[model samples]
Target: DAARQARYSFLWESAERMSCNRLATGHHRDDQAETVLMRLLCGSTLLGLGGIRPVDDSGRLIRPLLELSRKELEAFARCNHIPYAEDSSNLSEKYLRNRLRHKLIPEIERKYDPAFTRNLILLGEEAAFFRQCLEDRFRQLRDSLVEWAEGDSPRINCPAAAELPLVLRRYLLRRIVFDYTAGGVILSGRVLDAVDRLLVRGTSGRRLDLPGGLVACREFDFLSIGEKKSAPTGAQPEQIEIKGPGKTTIILGGLRWELSFEVRPYEAGTNNVFFQKEGAEGVWEERFDRDKLKFPLYAGAWRAGERIQPFGLEGTKKLKKLFLEKRIPCSMRMRIPVLRDSRGEVLWVCGVARSALGALSPESTSVLLVRALCLPVRGFTGVTIIDT
Candidate 1:
């Protein structure tokens, strides 16, 4: 499975890289017949039995030889004196397909019927026809039921999906998975069944991790399928010195941090010292007690075995433990910005926690405002603050 997936991935990557729209594969009728038999023996669905599609739904992958038998192709190649090499692995019994092609299929053809290959091809054609019909119906139902939200990730209304028939529901979920991953990964039958069960009976906040760093989250009434949160790479420690009321900018973890220092009167409105506003959606800004914090603040990525005295907490807690309680992905923990004092004590973890030392009080007179914005990644539009 892994090897096949890698080969297809390479094919797609090469196509995109070379700006080629069409990818052609030499999958012949014999291969199609074998695939149908193999899938049938594996108890595959009707769509699976459809075997090798001449053209993928995306209409980019084409199988020009799908209707031609392997024998016919070989005969033509010999007549033209075309050079070719035989793959030894095709004769190995270790692989199920090889066993079927060499042993089981030949046995069935000899003992039961000589026309077994032709029958399998016919079955594939019939299955393809039925699958196309089912897909049309599924598309209609999806149009009426699935509600897409505006964001990088795609979300669907689980409540509406639950109203669909079990088979349709599974199909819709699988389609969403495929679309979200850009065909990079496919959900297996077991995974699809698990997701279907979750859609029908699972409660909100439940989540399932799919392949290719994607996740399916069950919200109150919808399901969100998107890329998993990953931390920034190549982050290094930085220091920002606040001499007085001034502004400075520092870059870390592919993000820009604009620090504006000011001495403002302490407000009595909220106990929370950190006042934040979205300059624009996903752009973060926050205020802290500048006077209370120690000077020569260190800014850097999170480090292993670090501990922080979180506000309202009795004592310092392990950063890893805190991240777990916050449900932060492991890959993102180090990517998060960490603010520490000259004494090496953590003052804040960006979008997550504020140290007790940085908390505002009635006696606090000066405030330090920090604004952060991340440079857009390849697929994402903006940075989302992972609030705890």
Candidate 2:
């Protein structure tokens, strides 16, 4: 799977580098049948059993030779005196494709049916026709129901999807995963079943780790999909420093949501020593006493064993415990933004908790305001405001 992704990526990149709009491959009629058989053996949906596409979803990958058999291509080359060499890998049985081509397929033809390959092609054609029809409806559903969150992750509307037919519900979900992984991973039946279960019963903020390093999150009536957040194994996790003022955007490694920061005067507010804006809905906001915070504050992934004096709480509480209280999935705890002062004192944990240390006072005085904007796939914006 890795090799195929790399090869296609290389081909796509090479084509782009050459300023080519279309990248064609010689995937012949026999090859299409083999693809169908390969996917069948590996377990696939109606879409996968359709075999190689003449033009893939991106429309950049074109297999012009799909209608012509490999033998026909070879005969044409010989007639034209065009010299061509086959890759040595094509003869190696180490690959499943080659094994099918040289052994399994031949045996099936010898004993079971001579026209087996042709039948497979016909089946693929039928499947492809049905798939195209479904694809049209799927697009309409996606446009109206699926929201594209940060980094192109899809967030689905569960209530809306429940209205679709069962076959289409599964198909839509599967296609989201398939297209997101770029075919690097195909969810097995068991995995697909698990996704269905999650959709029906999973609690909000629940996440199920998926194949190909993607994750499925259930937030209320929405199903959020995004790359599994993970920094490199041993790399120093990226830390973005907000030097008070102006807007700044930082992209953390493997994290899709862009963190934005800004600091400005508190134009209108009740003249109170400490002021904070947060509620059961709307954007997340945190305000702190300007004098309590040090400049050049840093933000990074939450650290293990970190504790915070949660606002309105009696004493410091471990961030882990706080996460549990809020029903934040363990899978996402590590990626929550942990904001620290210049002295390395954690002042706030974005999306989860805020400390009482910088507890804001007067609303008139200027304060640091850091805002985060993440567009959820289901027609919502995740916004966070941090003020001095």
- What lDDT would each prediction earn against the true structure? 0.74, 0.73
Query: Who wins the TM-score comparison?
Result: 2
TM-score per prediction, in order, is: 0.54, 0.55
Off by over 4 Å in 1: 1-35, 38-48, 54-119, 126-245, 248-255, 267-271, 274-280, 283-286, 383-388
lDDT (tens digit, per residue) of candidate 2 on 1-388: 8988999899989999999999999899999999999988987777778888899878878889999989999999999999998999899899999999999988999999999999999989999998888888898888898877556678788888877787787788888887777777777778877887777777877788888788888876778877876554775567778777555544333333444545556655633233334452223345566656777888887766778887776988887777767766544555456778887777877666677776656543656665543334333334332322
Angstrom error of the Cα, residue 157, model 1: value is: 12
Tens-digit per-residue lDDT, 300-366, candidate 1: 7777788999887799998888877776654345456677776888877877877787777787776
Q: Candidate 1 — number of clashing residue pairs?
A: 0
